[model samples]
Target: MVRSRLYKVTRGTLRLLSRPVRRAQGRGGIVLEPYRGYGSCDEIFLIGRVFRQSRPAPDADRDSLRDLWRDVGRRIARRAVRGAAVTARFGGTEQRVATDRDGYFRIHLKPRAMPDCADPWRAVGLTLDAEPPVEARAEVYVPPAHARFAVVSDIDDTVMHTGVANKLVMLWRLFVEDAESRTAFPGVATLYRALHDGADGEQNPMLYVSRAPWGLYDVLSEFFARHAIPAGPVLFLREWGLSWTHPLPRRAEDHKRILIGNMLALYRDLPFVLIGDSGQHDPEVYAEVVAAHPGRVRAVYIRNVSADAARIAEIERIAAGVTAAGASFVLAPDSVAMAEHAAGLGLIAHDAVATVRAEREAAPPEPATGPLPGVLRPTEVPPTVVIEPEGGRRL
Candidate 1:
């Protein structure tokens, strides 16, 4: 409690001290910022911010680790979120919503009809009505009406090499490394592309859920682009709230479970292929999703980050239960293996397996390194926290 409180106070102090510099950069000016959002046939969820622009835009060419850091350095300031009139227009329907005090706004839509059958991606135009108006565009991916299944993947370790259990190393890789220099698990991109484009070549949505802080949103998005992985909504856990006086949510597991559950609920009819690593509580979190929403999860794929026999057994136990509950639970050693498993389950095309295998074979070898800390157990962590500098916190 004391640590969290002091953390907030410190961040608040820094923000106050940096206000002048940020204002000079037009952060004090009105702006509208939106991230990629997701939706189903009838419904859409759009999230974005309306605030004074705190940091100047970074170079769009920042696709490498070093170049990405250049942009990160440029965006060193922060701004307070303040409300504004935000609007979303699609399928001839326009709806409006107001940003929260934090300058975050979310809009929900029920389209009268979707786009033509040939194109599955929907473009949503978002604009903030304020002085010197700000405008941005976002996409809403609606998989084909008869799409067999969709994929929900974990970012760190599962797809990318983020040492989530080791906070210090995770922070370094998360912020300091650029996408080009940063390592994504070999063959993972090819496997994901196969899933996104499916065996039948139907465009299936790939939504990435991560425990990563939203501060690195740009870098992560760039990583996805470089990998040629089809992008959908990038949802992250609440920012870390280090508050001392009041209670805060603490379990990363709970936050993950809730988010995954919400996604399942939103796309009620679309079965999912859940992928995560053995590096964290994904096995437990995803297992719960499988048990709770039986049949909705077609398969649970766990990347083996730990070579530990006990951990494998634990995940296997969950796998067994998931199987009993009518889903396939795979203890995957590689992305290509998971691709093969998906194929065996008839979730993906048999030929896609060869594509993923070839990528694994052709990709450069992963630099030899020590294993990351063991995947966190559900019982081993505190509550999940959403980062909000309550009562003034400094960076």
Candidate 2:
């Protein structure tokens, strides 16, 4: 309770201090910022935000110091307009919803007509029921009927080199650094592309999930575009509250498990390949999801990011259970290692392994200089070998 109050007061003070800068940005009509959404044919889910602005604009390119400053200012200047009435329309279906306290609105509509999956995204129109009525369109990804499997990957340590275990380091990397300055794990883009284009040439759905807050969405989106990582309709991020007493909605494990569960339910016919790093609670969360759903998970990949003996041992035990429950669990040392295993399971083509290895070998080596004074360095454990079950080529 005390922490929550302190955090709220501190945030309020900061917002008050920035009022002039925000006001300088604009003083105009309402703006509807629609984020990409996804769902199946029977039901559609869409989310967006309402703000007081002339129009929506892309974040500034961060190639220069001035550009970086402008980008940061734009992000901070966004102020949500609460209690706005919004309507979503698609295929003769119209639904009304109101913005929450944070100026965000979510719409759930079951279209009367099934959308053609010839294209993955179907557009939905959005209108704000306000003066000078604002409007926007959202793209919702609906996978083809033939999608063999889906890939859900973590964003922080798994795809990019964000020091998430250390709060200060993570914040510095997220807010202070530009998109071009951020680094993705070597060959991660190649491996993810292979998974996205499955062995049979089916376009599998790739969804990125992260524990990072929504404030970093634009930066992360730019990071993916800069690095050529596979794009998902939406990057599932939490609104990490300012309330210190309840900083996050729930334990990280439960929050992730619930999201994965929702995905499983949304795509009932597709088995999932779950990917994350060992630095956080992903092993436990992915293990729980695998155990609960049994054979619905085709494989589990945990990047070897922790040198802690206890953590490694715990993950190994968890892996044993996940394997016993009919899923392949690999604590991979690098992107090529996971690529090789995916090839063995026929998830990706055997030739893709060479491509991944080449990409990995071509990546620049990390700088030898250590972190600045008092900065914590990341610890990584060696990869552990996994014994595949007999006839484990498919689930």
Candidate 3:
């Protein structure tokens, strides 16, 4: 009877201790679950938990428990959260939402067809609610035009291609891949070089706007140096904040637009070039730029990376608008084509303008093309060799 009582006490004590762990598991599960959020928009939250066996002594298993907890924490802190897939539809197509720990994600919606007017934006959020229940739903609303573009650019598949790989996969490749393993599109360097070189007092200074995070600055710099490409002042969007436990609320495109607007305000009269790839929101962003700064944009050049029909149509519309404005809108299959188009615009030329120094210090004129005057010519042909032949005997 005494032994049986002891057994009950032990059982109660074990349950009491296990309760905290269980609660932590439940709360921690939700803490790290990935979800989507908007800065000034609706916030989507996800929750997650860590699971483990409850047989070992709590103190004895402290190390293992701590390690497991840490592992899970690291995963969550690193923004690795598994949840329902969410896709945003804009420009008649869909784009996926990328998630990170703290149950936060930045959903990139297709920009409204008419950014100037309020149009309904749409997105489908999918979630699996097991430990952290997965939920799926569609979100539709118009986002405020928080900023305007002075410039926008394409990221992957435009600047660099780890080929057929996703952004996360490409990031891994960047770390593991060899120097030669990476590739830059043809003429990209030259295009950037021309822009960096600026427009000979007629063109505005260049701004490099891309979706690549600032962390890749060193790697990108190395890439440029390796290719002998000219470097320009780069403006990168910080992916997330150090204090951010969740994904930052700003969309990559939105971030770029914000930056563009800031630049425009600083140099109100300066024009800008919108360089981007077809793989993403370049068309939409460039279109927005055209709309915002009708005459301020110099050109929009899109590097074709995908063959999406809808994207193509959007590009056509953007091109037409650009053409109407006397500016250029080009869609090229590769960087070579982009270069050729730029060259056609007289943006890139071979003729060097004669500078003041060159004109002032040109070599002295070459000897006269025609015969010189008698006074100027040597006096060798004396006055008709008057019988100077054999001397002797005065004639």
Top candidate, metric TM-score:
2
Error of 2 at 110 (Å): 1.1
Q: What TM-score does each of the candidates earn?
A: 0.78, 0.83, 0.45
lDDT of 2 by residue, 63-105 (tens): 3344434433544555678898999998788999999987889
lDDT (Cα, tens digit) per residue for candidate 1, span 173-256: 654455665687778888888888777887888888877655556668778899887777888776532223322434553377
Q: Which model, 1 or 3, shows the larger TM-score?
A: 1
Give the winner by lDDT.
2
lDDT of 1 at 207: 86
What are the per-residue Cα lDDT tens digits for candidate 3 across 132-229? 54444433332233322233355465666543224444443343332343466655665555544433423223445545544344455566678666
Worst 10 residues of 3 by lDDT: 381-390
TM-score, cand. 3 vs. native: 0.45
How many clashes in each candidate? 26, 0, 16
How does each model score on lDDT? Answer: 0.68, 0.74, 0.45
